[model samples]
Target: MNELKISILGTGDMGGAIATALSRRTRHSLRLRGAQPGSTSALRLIDALGVTEASKEDFLASDIVFVVVPAASIEEAAAFLNGYQGIVVAVSVSGSVGRDGLPSSAERIATALPEATVVSAFTSIWSNVIREPGTSGKTSVFVSSDDDNAKEVVSRLATELGFEPINGGALSMALYAEVMGMFAVRLAMDSGYGRTISFHAFNAG
Candidate 1:
């Protein structure tokens, strides 16, 4: 299989964690970019992960781009990817998108990057959880994308990286995942449930 060239925009906690995880697994090339110039946090993350530093332009050359950034800056991220024709994925840990019958951040990003396949995943689970071994069994990573091929590729990567993939379906369905992230994070913190909580479906007979 051809090595996957993945680019991660915003080397914050989530982005850094993902880069470190991928670095230990695939022979793929991973690039981690800072949201701004001279960001020490990002630099530290890139160094720790042994990944290369990248610019917004580098995203155009990547096979997959993950935005582990804040929602407030998503518009800027989308604008940068507006020129990219690759797969663009958003990783929102704040659960920024809501399901109040409105367009989701994933939808907004897809619209911005019309030439690219946009997806939202890797949000429901905390970055710390990914650091633990064998935690994948109790974790579910929800993924939503309008493009089938893009979703499948992301699913495969998630699996290879030791995550249980949950196809939440079309990009619009990301609203639900985003909301669920809110509950999950809150519960993890307040209820002292740790970072291993996940959604499980059962037959309601």
Candidate 2:
């Protein structure tokens, strides 16, 4: 497992969890920066992970870029990364549906940053579920992207993080995956399954 250079752009719940997960893996060189770089939470995460503040170049230089911010900040994240040419995995659901009724975070991000190969991934799986990607666990990480190459790239990253990444195929399917992600969270909330639950694909074969 050669070291993969990765950078996380945010220190919110999702971002912090992701940085912690990556830090626990010795095969990664992780750098992180927060939208509010000097905030209490960001500083705490930085200190805890021993990750220095990242620069614009650091964010862009990584083999993968994780947009692990809150759901509300998806559009803003896209706007901030408008011109970046890289593979971006949206780890947040980015809200249920836009007023137009077909707004997925991945799609909105693509619309905002046309140059980037944006992929909707890790959005369905909660941070808690990933923190301990259990051995012999059935949990899975779903990924959607128009570019097959980018999709494969993210899938490998997911594997490194101890997740079984399922290729949902074509960016259009991201809507359904997003819906599934929302449904999973709501199910956990209502069914008492808690945040640690993640979906697994059982082969019918």
Candidate 3:
């Protein structure tokens, strides 16, 4: 795969973890940007990861932009990328309903950004697990999108990050992915497996 320009929005745990993993594993040019531009945490994360900070224009121009902000902030994040005409990997899973009664965060982003190809991924995997994929074998990442090309791009990214990307069907499947994520969290916490645990599908042929 070619070296792609990638921007990760939000400088929190999930965003920072993804940036760190991609920097160490792939040749993609990474740019980190916080939901609030020029935030101190964003700068600190950039310095810590040894990655460049992204400007608004840089963020929008990236080939693949990862929206790693909180579920409640999906609208704000989507509004920021209003005119971006690139692939947007929506990492937020808002359990709440969206406009037009869309159930998944990815669909909400797609609805907001009509021009951008919205792909839902990385919603189930925890940030700690993303930073250390080898610890859990090849963890499965469910990728769902209406655009096949966009889904393939995200799947390639997942593979590059030492993950097994599962084709979770169309964008509608993202609803299930979101629910699975919630269930995973519950299972981990309640089962005493800890947050580092991940799920894998075994094909019994």
* Model 2: per-residue Cα lDDT over 1-205, one tens digit each: 5677777877877788888888985568888777765767678887898877777777767777788777677777667665688888877674554334867877877887788888888777877876777665757778899899889878887888888889888888888787777777878899888887778886899
TM-score of each: 0.89, 0.90, 0.93
Candidate 1 residue-wise lDDT, 66-92, digit = tens: 987887777788876678998988786
Candidate 1's displacement at residue 23, Å, is 0.9
Q: For model 3, what is the alpha-carbon lDDT of residue 108?
A: 78
TM-score, cand. 2: 0.90
lDDT of candidate 3 over 151-197, digit per residue (tens): 99999999999999999889988888877777777778998777877
After the best TM-score superposition of candidate 1, give how far the Cα of residue 32 lies from its true spot, in angstroms. Answer: 1.0
After TM-score superposition, the amount by which residue 29's alpha carbon in candidate 2 deviates from its true location, in angstroms, is 1.9
Best by lDDT: 3
lDDT score for residue 104 of model 1: 69
For candidate 2, the C-alpha RMSD (Å) to the true structure equals 2.0
lDDT of 3 at 83: 89
Question: By summed lDDT, which 10 consecutive residues of candidate 2 come out lowest?
Answer: 91-100
Q: What's the TM for model 3? A: 0.93
Please name the candidate that would achieve the greatest TM-score relative to the true structure. Answer: 3
